[model samples]
Target: MVTTAGSAPTPGTILHLREQGFRVVATDIDPAAPGLYLADRGHLVPRGDSEAFLPRMRALCESEGAVAIVPLVDEELLPVGELDGDGLSVMLPRPGFVASCLDKYVLMRELSAAGIGIPRTWSASDPPPADVVADDASGGFVVKPRSGRGSRGVQLVGALAEVPAAVAASGYRADELIVQERVTGPEFTVSVVVWRDGGVQAVVPKEVLLKRGVTKYAVTRHHAEVERTCRAVQSALRADGPFNVQLCLDAEGRPRVFEINPRFSSTAALTVAAGVDEVAGLLRQAVTDGPRLTDTWREGVTMVRRWTDEFISEEEFASHGLAPAPTVPLVARGDDPAPRPRSTDPASGVAVRAR
Candidate 1:
């Protein structure tokens, strides 16, 4: 089962899982989400934060005989983490780790205490004393919500002096935000898949070339230090499931972890293409006696982004009890072909400009 079928990367996950022979059950608040149509069974459900969400999810799990649930969005992690009991596996980190990852300030402090390299971070309400901040190099600071997802509320101040204006513009209380010294370097998104017995399955690092809120274009790179940093994180946090780590290299080439998402990365498909197949592999491990996954994967794999469409007929929409928007045509146009078949060859469609 996969939640938030409307997200950008979820359709790929659902399709891949279906190909692996598991009956995919998809849920979303929007009836017309493309993934809802792609699944073996699709159900319209309340938003993750709503009071009715978990009860409805439990009902769906019982009815569909789902063995596990993959939550695609951050808001659903804490609530869905509760569903891990009763022979049901929630494909997320443990609940305590999930809670820590959600709060950026707390996460940073914990990692710092564990001797993991991280950006110098502080709560906005209790920023470092003036003397500490006075050494501000030309590089500025990053101001963002203490607990949030993606880049929605993030702001880059020109210098320490501009933090007040950025904070006032955000409309959140000072205590609700955090300030960190901005680090400059090429960024990376790393995937660390762990097993139920606290063993690391694989760690794949992708160097991001472009981005919006997530990695847009990335290429697989073999960085020993990056892998070491991520392994250290796993040892320190002990998140006994899949999680994504976002980090950057400092001037000395040491990895400085900036953020950690206690769930699958948006670039999980890239990990599959790199040959780890984390999503399907982890699902198999959760449900039955699956083979143990190894850390070996193809280096120099690249992932590119493009927009594609999924078509559904008007009758099919009505059959699924979804209301169709007038602006969206259910029938395929002459110029529009069916959604292209996914390439089995890892290097078939995307360019591999690995250096």
Candidate 2:
């Protein structure tokens, strides 16, 4: 299996899978994306929006004899979801599920109607319902792009009147924005792995001690309420692969979720540490016809992330094609393999025989 993206999860996954005897093909649009450095072979490819993207990606797979493609970023998910599979095994939810998750508005509506606790949300084009557009600013709201990543273009509005300008300033049209009541409570980012049969394999809800979109500091935790709520949402979405959910405890301490990500979370290393190894599940699934659904995991594990610097001299950068970045300290580093192409048995569906 070959995975794309050089983000947090991708690097750890590359390391983890490599340790399991899978060759890593690291790819990213940014040449300096640190994960690329750890790949058995790395490709600096075009952005997902480029017309050349899919064609080039398929070409990469065929050229490298890669039978599976794992995507770790949002921008690449939809396009990767469209892959016809051919002889390649790709683990993506259906396109409709991908669409619903990507569009925050739709996702919230669906979840809200499913009896999931979601922040009261408003759309730009539609005048707020009576409860949302009240003159009083009793419930503070946050406005953000309809489809966005991270905390970018997010605006806190004291009252509904402030939403319009915030939406415009956010570089999104009014209809392309969503304003929702701001949540206040300790937050948790829960990741769940599901099989194609709609069976949930595992759920890891980690308490976020600190974060910058990606988890910076976390501890493996098990809140019965949070785990229950996350699984409810997981079933509601019919999520068929690895996906993450963002939830914050409400004033009442209920785990009210606000977002769902249809890929592996940045804390893949943490999950691996916590005994819920997604890369392992994916690697096995990629090579096999199904996934194992037994639940066995370690809880109450802790993780703290620190930066690393992979400094290289100018000549080294030019000669070895180096990048100035470090592996996140929590991510494990494995011995780099000398093999040019990793082996996978298509019919048998095994990467390397369990020896």
Q: TM-scores of the models, in the given order?
A: 0.89, 0.83
Q: What tens-digit string does per-residue lDDT give for candidate 2 at 1-355?
A: 3445445556666767788877777666555556666667776555565555676677778777876777776777888777746777666666777789899999999999999999888787777778755544465788877786677667888877777777777767888888888777889988787757777788888999998756789988878898888778767878777788898888889877788887777777888888877767765776675457455778888888876554546664455444422222222213212211221212211111110
Error of 1 at 182 (Å): 0.8
Residue range 119-235, candidate 1, lDDT tens digits: 888888886657547788466889999887888689998788898889888878999999887888879999999966888888999999998877899999999999998989889
Candidate 2 yields a Cα-based lDDT of: 0.71
* Candidate 2: residue 99 lDDT (0-100): 86
Displacement of the residue 60 alpha carbon in candidate 1, Å: 0.9
Question: What C-alpha root-mean-square deviation, in Å, does candidate 2 show against the real structure?
Answer: 8.7
- Residue 252, candidate 1: C-alpha displacement in angstroms: 1.0
Query: Which ranges in model 2 have alpha carbons more than 4 Å from their true place?
Result: 1-5, 134-139, 289-293, 309-355
Error of 1 at 303 (Å): 1.1
The prediction achieving the highest lDDT against the true structure is: 1
